[model samples]
Target: MKQDVDSAKAVMRELFAPTPLQHNLFLSDKYGARIFLKREDLSPVRSYKIRGAFNFFRKALAADDPAERFVCASAGNHAQGFAFVCRHFKKPGVVFMPVTTPPQKIDKTKAFGGDFIDVRLHGDIFDECYAAAKAHSKETGALMVPPFDHPDIIEGQATVAAEILDQLPGDANPDLFIIPVGGGGLSAGMTGYLGGRIGNESFVFCEPEGAPSLKESLTAGKRIKLDQVDNFVDGAAVAEIGSRNFDALKSFAADQVMLIAENAVCVTISELLNVEGVVLEPAGALAIAALEEMDRQSIAGKTVIVIVSGGNFDFERLPDVKERAMRHSGLKKYFILRMAQRPGALRDFLNMLGPEDDIARFEYLKKSARNFGSVLIGIETKRPENFDALTGAFDDAGLRYEDITDNEVLASLII
Candidate 1:
């Protein structure tokens, strides 16, 4: 398996150099551990997805009577990777993406493939788009290059683990590894390559709290398909772990996997961008975010490696990201306030705000009401404790209000 991975890496060298494995000072200091980041985000496609796509194509082409074309379905990183490899191999391919996929991703995927691939906008969700790609593959006899789940794709992803072993400085060994899970390609690949070589205790898996397919499957002792999935962490929002990938991970106990909140992931993404000047998509930040949930004593003085999966973030979503981060950090909140429909009502509410508190949003939700009107308000503060003071003032002033910050349904409908 190592030799096969080495061969894959050798072939990949023709496309891009191995991504850097750098020691992150800020994280190391904060976590009390020697923390290194496997910068897969620095790949040519800004993701490790390129590895699987390229290796899958390479093996298919080498086989006798290989399909003349290829097809894949992905809304983000994988689509870009598949497109990139198609262009590199000069092979005609088709990529199906969800119609709701951000334009930035769509444009980048098209740019990477150039004339080698055609981008098709399909259904609004990934499963629907994937179905369309499968239909196309069946009709045209084009090879289906799955994002994960195949042997070749898993082998290709395993190259990342191979690189890690070679890149560690001065024969130093890592005590822990943080890997993010989606369809489980990277986790499965890395474990398959390092399972016997390294102790299983060294591995720590992370998944979005909204999509715990891998954890749920491990608990059930089988692959379990989720009825619904949250797409906020688009890169890791998988409804089911791939069958082949699960085989590689099934031995692990369910407790080994940690569920990271989508909002908490946004906080990590924001911190990395603001403090470290490093941009990472939500999934890319998962491994790092999981560190916040770990007991510092467990990792103190130990060496840890976190795989940063991808950095294909669209700037257009920065505001949304910041909003989520602020909400998660308790620095921002939304509320529905009952305002007296009379003079000085607005001034009364304004006076209740603390000096550090600033109104970010305010609108009269129901002005037609006779005596009292519903006011939708959003507030931002410098610290989490500031909310206590502000709420106390509101109570003292007899201001009728309900905090909707943690109310997902209300926040979604109004804020």
Candidate 2:
């Protein structure tokens, strides 16, 4: 395993130099601890996925049939990485992506592979695309390069850990390492390598709350598929944990894994973007979000390394990201209010709002009653606590209302 990791590191250098390991002052001051960010986002493909893709292609090309073709299913960073490797090796490859994949990613993949790859828009969901890729590989005798399950892929991904240990100062072995989990390639690789190197270092695994595949698999003591997964965090929203990756990580303590809410993660993404000028995808913000859930005292003076997984964020989703961040931060809220139908009723409700409150949205839901009407209102405030004051004013004015800010079902349908 050590030799494989070392070889991966050496091979990676041939493609691109090592990713930077710079100390993060913003995070260090915020957490009152030394924080170093492993900028895997700065990789050639702007993600760490290229390492596994290159390694898979390298090994397959050296096999008995060096001329064999390659195929894979992905919609985001993986597709770009596979396309990059295909062009680098001058091998014919096919990539299957969901029909709903963004145009930006499709174009980027095409640009990377140039004439070396064919892109196929298969089904509406990833499962459909994956199935198509497998069928094509089996029928054409081409190699199927899995996104995160194979031994070579794991070994290649482990090279990130090797680089971190080699790059850090001799006295700076991180006491805590925070890793983000998707299909578990990065997390499994880092944990496997670091577990062997340092006998006592701690590792915290972060996954999107909407797609808790690793948490579910760990609880069940085996790999399990979720019936439904929210794909808002597209990069890390995997429905099932990889079987091979699970085998490597299942032995870790269940409590070591931390699941973060998708909306909460959006807040971190926005903060990093605005404050540090760092653009991170949803999965990229996982390790940073995990820091908020840790015991501050335990890591107060300790050295910590947080892996910034990828920077494949699409600017088109900026509005949705901001919306989620506002909701998570409690600065924005949606409510259904029943108000008196008199001409002064609207004025009365407006007066009830605190000085810090602002009305972002207002619409009439129903006006059936002669003396009463229902209104859908969206409010934004300078601080979350302002909502409490506004609600108290509502109580004093006898305004009937229901706060649906955290009601997923109602908010999904009405908001």
RMSD of each: 1.2, 1.2
| Each model's lDDT | 0.94, 0.89
lDDT of 1: 0.94
lDDT of 1 by residue, 1-415 (tens): 8889889989999999999999999999999999999999999999999999999999999999876899999999999999999999999999999899888889999999999989999998888999999999999999999999999999999999999988999856889999999999999999989977888888999999999999999999999999898888889999999999999999899999999999999999999999999999999999999999999999999999999999999888899999999999999999899999899988988888889999999999987999999999999999999999999988888888899999999888989
Ten-residue segment with the worst summed lDDT in candidate 1?
A: 165-174
Backbone clashes, each candidate: 0, 0
Worst 10 residues of 2 by lDDT: 194-203
Best by lDDT: 1
